[model samples]
Target chain A: MALELLKERWSSAINVLKVGAVKEEGGTRASAITVGGQTTLPFLLDEGGMPHRPVVAMEIFDVAPLEWPVSLLEPFGDAVKDPVKWAKKCINEFKADLICLTLKGTHPEAENISADKAVELVKNMLKEISTPLIIIGSGDKEKDNDVLARCSQATKGENCLFGLAAQDNFKTLVASCMADDHCIIADSPIDINIAKQVNILITDMGFKPEKIAMHPSTAALGYGMEYVYSIMERSRLAAFVGDKMLAMPFIIFVGQEAWKVKEAAANVADEPGWGDERMRGPLWEAATAVAMLHAGADILVMRHPEAVATVKRSIDSMMKGNND
Target chain B: MLVIGELINGMYQNVEQAIKTKNRSIIHKLAKEQLEAGADMLDINAGPHGADPKETMRWLIETIREVTPAPLAIDSTKLDVVELGLKLAGEGSMINSTKADDEKLDIYVPLAKKYKAKLIGLTMDKKGVPRDKNVKCELAAKILAKCMEMDLPLEDVYIDPIVLPVNVAQAQCAELLDVLREFKLISDPPPQTVVGLSNVSQGTKQRSLINRTYLVMAVASGLSGAIVDPLDKELMDAMITAELLLNKNIYCDSYIDAYRKR
Candidate 1:
C-alpha cells in the first residue's frame, strides 16, 4: 500500500554551513569537508532531499597537558605528549575523518605559547595528518586572534577552521582566516539569534556561507544536551523544510563537552558502580555524538579513539539505512 | 506562509469523539479537506483529553499518515505519545512542542532526536508566560541553546512565543509582535517563528476578523508561519497579503493572478 504523504512548509529556514573545502586548489589540505546541504529538513530525504549527511571530525589539542579527563588522557598517554604523534594516532588508530586542533596553551595561564608557536603546532599537525584540520583558540579572545591569525597564515591553503568567530572579537579572527583563505568556526555562546547574527556578520564580511561552520554550542549528555539537540534539530528542520538562508551544514563540539560531564569523566568509585570510567567515558561521548548525529549535526568534534570508532560505526550503520 | 491546519486535536470535542469511534472516514475527511484547502502540514494533536493520550496519539498519527503527505506535526505534551507518533509517521515530521523550560527541553528534545523530527518550541518556560518581549527573547535564546546542544539544525525549530489573551491584556498583541520580531533576529540559521494564530482571537467578537487581523500583523512582524484554519478564505487571504507585503512573495507579474486565483 502506498503511504500517503504530507506537505511540510517552513516559517523561516535556518542556514546550513558546509564543513570541508572542496577539491580546490586553494587549501593546503588534500581536500575539504562540506556539510549542511539540505533542500528539506534533516532526514527528510524522501520528502525533499538531503544532499549531504553530517560528517564526523576527531578532536586534537595543540599542547595536550593538564585538564583532560583521565579516561581520554590514558588512551594516548605518550601520544598526548606530542601533537604530531597524537594526530597520527587519531587518524590511524581512531580512523578520524578530520582533526580539530584546540590551541589550549595559547591562553594567558597555560603554556601561553606565542603566535609563532601556535602556528608551528598547527603546521606540525598538518604535516603529521592527511585529514582536514579545525584550529581553535583557548577561549581568550585577544590571544586567540593573535595565534589564529598566525596559524591561519601558516596553514594557508589547508582550509583549516581558524579561531572561532565569536560575536565580540570575530573581526580579527575572521580577518586572519580570510587573509590565509581558511575556513572558520562561526562560534556563538549558545544562542540561536547570536548564531544567526554571527553568520550574518561573517557573510556580511564577504565570507562565503559554505566556508563557515557554526558551533551553536553543545551540552554534555545528562546535562542539558537534549535542549541543544532540540534547537539544532529545529534549525535544520526549518532550513530543509524551506528556509534556504540557514541551510548550511552544522558542526558539533561533542567531545569537548561530552567529556566534561560527570557521566563521561567521573569514575565508578566517584559515582558508585557506574561502571568502568574507561569504557563508560567513551560510551558517554559516543552516545552524545550519536544522538547529535540524528539531530543533524554535520561535523562532530570528538575525543577518545574508542568513541570516535564507535561513532564512525554508528554513522556507517545510519548511512546504510539511508542508502536502503 | 505555511498554514498547518489546527484540527485533529483531542482538545476539540469532535476530534475526541472521532478518535474514540476509530472513525477512519472522519479522520480521512479531516485530513483530505485540510490538505486540499492548502494546509502545508496537518497538526495531529491528541493531548490528554481524559483518555490514554499515548494510545490515541499513536492511532491518530498512524491513521493520519496513512492519508496525507503534508508531514505530521506530532502534537502532545506526553513523551510517550510523541515517541509513538514519530515512529509511526514518515520522515520530515515535526513534534508539536517542547517548551522553553529546562525540564521540558530535556524531555522533548530527546524525543525529537529519537524520532528525527522538527519541533515547535513554546517560549513559556517554568517561569510561566513572560510579559516582557525581552524575556521572551531570552526564553528563545535558551531554547536555541538547547537546539545547538542537540545538534538539531536551528532551521527545524519553529518558535511559538506564548500568545496571551487579548481580552485579558489589550497590549498582548503588541508584545507578541515584539517577541516575534526578536525571534526573527536569532542565530545565523534562525529557527522559524510561528504562532497558534487563533489564540489571540479567544473571547473576541468576529473571531475570523480578529484572527485574520492579528495573523496579518504577526506575519508583518516577521512571523514566517502559523497554525491556522486554512479553510477560512479570509485567513488565507491575509496570509497571501502578508507575504506579499513582507516581500517574501513576488507581486511583479503574478499579482492579479495570485490574488484572484486565491
Candidate 2:
C-alpha cells in the first residue's frame, strides 16, 4: 500500500539509469552510482516521492590547475599539485560519494599532454580513488574525443563516466563507451534542443540508452542560471509521460561551472562588502547545485569540499521519506 | 486557435471499446460533440488497448471523417499505425507523433511529406524522456531537423514535450513554462507547443481543477495547441480564461460569447 501510495503521489518517478556492472553483477567498481529515479523535484518530500539520493562527485584535475581562483586555492593547497592526493583528499576529507577527474590538461593547449600521459594520470586516479570516477575533457571538442577514447580504454573495467559526448562527436565517445562498457556524460550547451540532439545522436549510434547521463548545461546563478534550471526541469517532465525516448537520467556540472564564476569565488574587496569569500563561494556552489537538483539533476559534478558536504546533507534531509 | 480535440483516446475504456466495435454511433457522437465544443481537429488514438490498433484506428478515422469534416490527429506509438491512419485520413490530417528519435523521423517525415500532413513531434528522442527543459527543446530541434531535412514545412511541425504531472513533479510546471518561453524565442516559425493536458492531472484529486488551472498557465505560456478533451467544461472554461488573459481574446468579451454558446 505504501508503495502504491508512493507511486500514486509520484506519478512520474523519473527513471534513473544505474551505470556499471558490479563484480557481484559482472564488472568492477566497488559499487555503482544510481541517478534519476526521482518522483518529485528536489526536496519536496511531502508532495512527491524521492528516489536514489543525489550523488555528489568531487572534482579532481588531471594537472595542477592554474586557473582555479585564489579564493578556492586555500582548501586544497598542496593537494592541488598532485592529482592522486587531490582524489584522496576529495574522498577522505570531503566525503564525496564519487570523484570527477577533469582531463583539462590534456587539451592541446592546456598541458599538451599525450594520450599516454592522459592514460597514466587516469591509471593513477583509478588506483588512488576507490569511489566511482568521472573523467571529463578539457572542454575542447576534438581533443576530448581522442583523449577520452584513450582514457576509456585505460579505465576499461571501472565503469567511469567519460565527461563528454557532444552533438558533433558523440559517435566516437559512444564507441569508446561501448568498447569500455563505461557510461558517458551527454553534455550540451544551455539549449534543450542541443541536449536532446546529443542524446539522440548518441543512441542513434546503437549505444545503450541508460549509459548516457545527459548534462543539460549549467549556468552560474547570477548569469542566466534560471534559464539552465528551467531547461533541466522541463527535460525531467518530458521523461515521465509516454515519451519513452527521453527518459534517461540527467547529469549537471554543478560545481565546476557554477563555482568558477566571480560571483561565486570572488573575495573581500573583490565585490565590496560581499561577506567572506570562503563561506560565500561554497554557498553559491551549494545554492546552484540545490536549485539544479530541484530542477531534476540526478548527478551533480561538484567542487569545494564544504559545498559537497553541505549538498549531501541537504539531499539526505530532503530524502528522509515524506511518510512523516 | 488550433484546438486539437484530444477526445476518443483508448486511455478511456469506453472509447477503446467503441473503436474495437467500429461502433460508428459512439464514434460519430464523440466526434460531433468535439466539433460542437469548438475543436479544430479530432485526435484519434487506439493506444495499447487489447484491440487491433490499426483496424480500430482506421475505423475511428473513417467514421469520424464521415460524420464531421474536422481534420484527424492520427495518434499512436506505432509509426505504421500513424501511416495507415494518414492514408485513411485522405487530406489535411495531422500525424500525432514524430519523436525526437531520428528513427521515428525516418518513418514519420516521409509519411507526412507523402500525405502533406501536419505532424506532432514528441519532444523526446532515442535516449528516451529528458528531465530537463533544454533537452526537450533539443529533442524538438532534432525532430525539426528531420522535418527540415525532408523539406517538411516548419508550420507543420507541432512539438509536444508532453506536460509533466504537477503534484508529483512540482517543479515540472515551472520548467514547462520556461521551455515554452524558450520555444517561442528559438523556433523559426516556432513549431507550435502542444501538450496532453489531461496527463497533468492523471493521479491527482480534483483533477479537473488542477488540469484547468494548468491549462490557463500553459496557454499563457504560448501553448499553440493542446491535445485536450473538448467535453470537459472546466477545462474549456480555463482555455477561454487563458485566451482572455493572453489577449488572444480581446477582453473577457470572447469568454462570455464562448460560455453563452456552450
Distance from true position, residue B254, model 2, in Å? 38
After superposition on all C-alphas, the RMSD of every candidate to the true structure, in Å, is 19.2, 19.2
Which parts of model 2 are misplaced by more than 4 Å?
A1-13, A46-48, A321-324, B1-262
Q: What's the TM for chain B in candidate 1?
A: 0.92
lDDT of 1 by residue, B1-262 (tens): 6578997787888888888888888888889888777687889888566568878877887687677767888877777777788888867888888888888898787777767788888888767888888888888888888988988777778888867668888887888887777776777656688888778878888789988988888888878679988778778877777786776533423332233322
Docking quality (DockQ) of candidate 2: 0.02
lDDT of 2 by residue, A248-310 (tens): 677888777876688887777768788888889988998888887778778888888888888
| lDDT values, one for every candidate | 0.76, 0.77
Please report, as a residue range, the 10-residue window in candidate 2 chain A with the lowest summed lDDT: A3-12
- Docking verdict class for candidate 2: incorrect
User: Which 10 consecutive positions of candidate 1 chain B have the poorest summed lDDT?
Assistant: B253-262
